[model samples]
Target: MFRTQQSRSGNDLRFSLLILPGLRRAGMVVRLLMCSVLLLALTALSGKFGEAQAAGSTAGKHRAASSGAKGRHRSVRKKAALPAKARTPARGRRHGRAAAVVAGATAATAAAAVAASPAAPAKAITTNTKPELLPRCGFTEASRRHIFSRGVYVLDEETNTPLFERNADTVAPIASVTKLMTAIVWLDQKSLPMANRLEVTEDDLDNLKFTHSRLNVGASLSRADMLHIALMSSENRAAAAMSRDYPGGRPAFIAAMNARAQALGMPHTHFENATGLSPENVSTPRELAELVKAANRYQLIRNDSLDKQKIINIGRGQLQYINSNRLIRYGQVNATVQKTGFINESGHNMVLRLLVHDRRPVIVTMLGSGTADGSRLDGVRIAKWLNCSLN
Candidate 1:
């Protein structure tokens, strides 16, 4: 029995040893599996972290690029807001182009305006240095209608004022009105007697003008009668005879006339004869007014000139002479002194010391009338105008 027991124990030991080796192998395999599982989980976690870091880096780069772009846009805006002097070269180029366009448009508009508009007379040259002689007045136009004489002068005798005048300085023939000066020169001779009879001869005949004479060649008359006929009738024979009978004869009488005219400021007067038959017998209206004023101082001249009619008895027959002035003959005007004259070259002429309202003496002289009664009509018009305008 003992022997069988020992053999069984040895077999049990062998079986135990084999079982230990197999159990050791199974424990090693389980520990290796657990380590591999833990390594796999750790690797998956590291991959997820790496992916998160890459995504964050890419997002940061995009944000930085967007911010840089905005800053550049702001810088460009700031430069654009500067003034032209402070502007960059690029901005100056833009402004220069715009100014060029405006200048071209302005030039074109000015050229069009100049092309749309019309063109301007020439003047005469004169060398006349004489000062104007016509009186300056506001009523020149109105007074022109009231006067018909080519030469006219109206003066206020009392005040020695000029009322109206036209061409008064024009030199013209005096015609029979020359007798006024002749009468003045004759009367100035105090030695000449009024009752001295003077014989009419062939020299008294009007040889130049060839005018008719009522007094015959052999007729005789006193100085008073001769003077009366000469002044009243404007008889050429009577005037010639009186000049011949003067103290120094015809030459002396003519000299006295010119001297008297010069003394009276008659600058434009020249007398060739006493009868005013010659065309050379010239005087201006301004000068003739002075002659009238001087002659009016004589009572004989004033009476004879204003006389309507007078009867003179010579040896042959009874003769009647009438004043030539129609104004005095018809009593149409209260003229204190007057004379009438007519010649082809001188035209109709008249001078009068007209008494307005029987008080004021207005001297009016007219020359170069176109019509026979033109001077008379002018006198009437002057009277009417003075009455209407002044009164």
Candidate 2:
């Protein structure tokens, strides 16, 4: 019985030893798994933090660029608002170039960031309040070299060759130069006798520009006298009266003016009214040169336009109308055909057909002079140039 009890105790002791080693090994495996899970959690949190930091940095850069562009735009506006006397041109130009460069860089970076995001609204950047100023007239730098007038053209009447040209193709208001055409159209109708007396009425008053005329309403004059005054003095009333006296009235006269212009190869020329009070009466310098050539064919236009003064009897009084062209009255040029015109839109305009050397006929037309004297000076300069060329 004692031997049997000792064997059972030994068997229990061996089983206990084996179970303890297996329990220790299982604990070590469980601890290793827990450590690995903790490490994975820490690594995941660090990666998420890095991503958030990068997104925040990108957003901050975008905001900074947007604000910078806005600041530049405000600065440019302030500079433009400065008084002309206060601003130095050299400094202004430098700042302008710098602003342009900064603006371009900001726009490119912002565009790149926007393309990456695609959900953000794009901000507009403005650089200046007023755009850059550009030249209004003259085709080439050489053509605009010395000419102050907006448009200038010199043509040799004999050969119809353009001697000099500046903004010659630009169509603009011609003012009372339309009268030359009016005289031509009026005389074209041989049936309409010049001896027939035409009375100035309220309809003849310039309603478009409210211009003054010495030929008062209700004054009576022959058709020939109306043409004479219109061509010589740029009398708006006389031209309007003649247009009203046409077979089909003012509308027909206007149509005839346009038709005559078309026939004369003046495709860009248009006439809204005979008196040239309307700004719609437009012609190019080249086209007007052709017009001068055509009007020179009329002997009466040549006779009346060159006259310095005309004393006409009107209602028991004689009103002597002086020629409007200072170039003619002052003997500045021996103009065969000369007409001067002015309006707010057309400026001081003049067309002249004059003998330059001995008998070399040349036509000079200038438009957009600031003053009457300016127009006269332009004509004088052109005449001198022509004389030099002829010699």
Q: What is the C-alpha lDDT of each candidate?
A: 0.80, 0.82
- Residue lDDT tens for model 2, 1-391: 9999999999989888998789999999999999999999999999999999999999999999789778777877889774332222456888878876777798799888864542311122111111111111121234335566789887877766666677889989999999999999988978889988899999888777787778877798989888888998988899999899998999999999999999999999999999887889999988998899889999999999998999887765888998998888888897789888889999999999989776989888998888888888888877875665453
Report each candidate's C-alpha RMSD, comma-separated, in the order given.
34.8, 20.3
Give stretches of model 2 more than 4 Å off.
Answer: 1-146
Report how far residue 180 has shifted in candidate 2, in Å.
0.6
Residue runs of model 1 more than 4 Å from their true location after superposition? 1-143
Q: List TM-scores for all candidates, in order.
A: 0.63, 0.63
Best candidate, lDDT = 2
With candidate 1 superimposed using the best TM-score fit, by how many Å does residue 119's alpha carbon deviate from the native? 38
For model 1, how does the per-residue alpha-carbon lDDT over 28-55 read when each residue is reduced to its tens digit? 9999999999999999999999999998
Give the C-alpha miss distance for residue 255 in model 1, angstroms: 0.5
